[model samples]
Target: MVASSTTDAELSPTVRVLDPEGRDIRFVSALDPAGVVAHGWLRASHRAPDAERTLPYRPWHPHGRLDPLTPGAAVPLDIEIWSTSVVVDPAGHRLAVTVQGRDFEFPGEDPWPRSYGVDTKGHAIFLHDDPDDRPTSVFGGVTT
Candidate 1:
């Protein structure tokens, strides 16, 4: 019998949020950076229903108030993209990020100012206001 194999790119990648206890958190969508500069946002598609069957639904507020380090303070979380994950720590010195099993670390710095929230349908929505001159949507050639 012939054997078949698949590369990391061929497989569908998943974006996951892990709580401090290492438990997976359920989210509708996530903001995927278009590039290193964070000029725009790319909608991340949720995994197939079969893949998410085992995951539990846990709501999280990304815009909640944050306090300095303390015993009961906000828990640090790790955002996983595909085979890689990054421990998101505001006070950490290094930002670890891996994509498709490739290391992509950078110096810890302030993140871009962008708004995101969950929609009525429980889908994560990234609020991006395009410039007046730029096209609103990538398809249909629609412009502002």
Candidate 2:
């Protein structure tokens, strides 16, 4: 199993399954029906953990506080991957854990129905289209 980040501002928080019957994994994005499994990430400033609620599998963070990032410095950030139920057959399918800069989208027509009242295409209602907020930025870049 191999995983890596393409940028400094990447989301990461791993998982462990002790199931005696255990055998698989993948790079699934959150809300991606392609094979929805689990995903999570926290803003760098919101990485403060709630010590009392922290656990081995899941690390809880309190959003009440914000910590500014130090330029050109590396910091540890904890993430929480929302759990899901999926059956994976290692022999037939390869598990892919995607760690990318943007949200995942359906290449063709949206398989999700709009009448259902959710993002049939991709992304939440955050509507990060405002250029002023710099929706297209990354860490250690001129933008971000």
Question: Highest TM-score, which number?
Answer: 2
Report the C-alpha lDDT of model 1 over 1-144, residue by residue, as the tens digit: 001121101111234444465433332224433222111121111111233333434222232332222222223222223223445454423332223211122223435233353221111232223444222332112111
- Which lDDT value does model 2 have at 68? 58
Error of 2 at 70 (Å): 1.2
Model 2 lowest lDDT segment of ten: 1-10
Please report the TM-score between candidate 1 and the true structure.
Answer: 0.18
lDDT, candidate 2, 1-144, per-residue tens: 112221224343323222234433323344433323554555565678999999988889878886655545566766777776666544545444554434433345545534236563433322333455433443434213
lDDT of each: 0.26, 0.47
Residue 56 error for model 2, in Å?
0.7
Per-model tally of clashing residue pairs: 0, 5
Scored by lDDT, model 2 comes in at 0.47
Model 2 ranges with Cα > 4 A deviation? 1-35, 108-112, 115-118, 122-144
